[model samples]
Target: MRELLTALLSQDPTIEVVGSATDPYQARQMIKQLLPDVITLDIEMPRMDGLSFLEKIMTLRPMPVVMVSSLTQQGAEATLNALELGAVDFFPKPKLDMKRGIEKRADELIHKIKTAAQAKVKTLEREQDTPLALNPLSNIKFSTTEKIIAIGASTGGVEALRVVIKNLPANSPAVLVTQHMPEKFTKTFAERLNKISAVSISEAKHGERVLPGHVYIAPGGKHLKLHRSGANYLCQLTDEEAVSGHKPSVDVLFRSTSEAAGKNAIGVILTGMGKDGAAGMLELREVGAKTFGQDEASCVVYGMPKAAYDIGAVEHQVSLNKITEAMLNACGAAKDRHIRV
Candidate 1:
């Protein structure tokens, strides 16, 4: 194990394997002695389970952590819990054949580690500064017409989506999301999102009726389209080829919503990598939809929104803190909350 880890470090000039251990006791001692930039943990380590050790480490000395997990039910659950507990990400495989998994995915693991090492990890306890107003819409009168809100994101989207969706009123029009993530993670993510928000959120189902006051999440590994059904718009999820290098591409969602929902749809492109949603956002703009992008200052990485802005797809640029209110304004609420004049 140490040999493989050493090889991985040597291959990457930027990474230095400070220290590693075969058990949680040794791991703790190594951490105390080395204080490495990042830790790649094996979930099945001896002495103490990786998840429990991770919980302890995060509670005692919060730092960037990435877990190596198997593609089994237990591994997935553990990884999800670790993520919720402040671990940045997990690399998964179905086998314990270390040579094949480690060598074949060394580059990917290297990238993940580099990103994790630079991440600003905030423990759950440190995030309680501003409580989200549980009923922010108590005093505002919303419009009667049905509306649909379309949101696009990638990279650091999970946490961002939570902040925006949990604040949306139960009466807010149908919301659709296109976030760049793998197939497995999206289901878990949707389930997690549903638990925190007042509005109902679910993974998008093919041929499902998209109703007002419900949020439809685009399933990962597929494209989601919106079609008009008499005065209503319904969702259609498909296993189509990847568009813009992503199956559930933001451009695909934005374009479909533009053709079907037109002026009734609101398009928002949040923090992400690459230029996936730029052209589609322009299409939405041509069809008279309000479009927004998270400003560079608040973005973990500013690639996606920057591309959209460069192509004139985004009409307004706001920080992560202001997006939920902006969506409400796009829905014809009193414009004083999420948007600035």
Candidate 2:
């Protein structure tokens, strides 16, 4: 597997293949010597587990790390944990036909590695066992069920979305999220978020009625869109062709929100590595919906938000910590609470 990965990565002229290690101990020594821009760590290792080594790396060195994980339930959970622990991104390891699968996804692996190299790595702080306290906005009673929050993210989205969602109040407006993830991973991601967040979160199902206090994540291989069914909103899932090189493209979600919810929707473009949501955000803004972008300083990779901001699609630029409050304030759900940009 290491040989295949090394050979594949070496094919890319832009990516330099550094020394490969047989275990985390060897990898540690190599890292100290080579000081590579990015490290791709496998989730499972012989001596020290990838997650444990990842924690140590984030704590001591704090360099961007991309996890190579298996496409399984355990892998999904572990990959999400790595993301929470400050890993930049994750790539699913091939399960069957290793050589063929790896070769087929060679481009994707290279892209992830390159993106990780540019990510703004951060130290991993110890997480509390308890869920975060509900945002102060929870005290305010939202008046209407008409508002919808549409969020688009990729690359660093797992952690970014967690930070934004965990702070939202239980009574917050319905949230529709389009995050780039694989099939099984989205379900695990939603379940993990549900455990920590005040709001109910699940992978969106086709035709499910979108409700307040709930978050609908776009199913891994499907696109999630908001549609008006009579007077109430419904979650619409489609297996349409990939838009913006992503199935659950943020562009598809935001464009649908623009058409279906218009001024009643709030669009947020978070950290990512592409321009998927920029045009859709512009569409939302043109229709009078409030739009927000995660500022570069707070983003691990400021690609999507930067693209949106550059095109004037974002009405307000906000940090990751304040995104939830800003969205709630825009929805007019937080009475008397003003978001200080």
On TM-score, the candidate that comes out on top is 2
Q: 90-172 in candidate 2: lDDT tens per residue?
A: 98986788789989999999999999989998888875633446356567677677999999999999989998998788888
CA lDDT of every candidate: 0.80, 0.92
Residue 7's lDDT in candidate 2:
91
Clashing pairs in 1: 325-338
What lDDT score goes with residue 88 in model 2? 93
lDDT of 1 by residue, 285-321 (tens): 8888999999888765577889999999999999988
Top-lDDT candidate index: 2
For model 1, the superposed segments whose C-alpha errors exceed 4 Å read 1-10, 32-35, 55-62, 95-107, 123-133, 138-140, 334-341
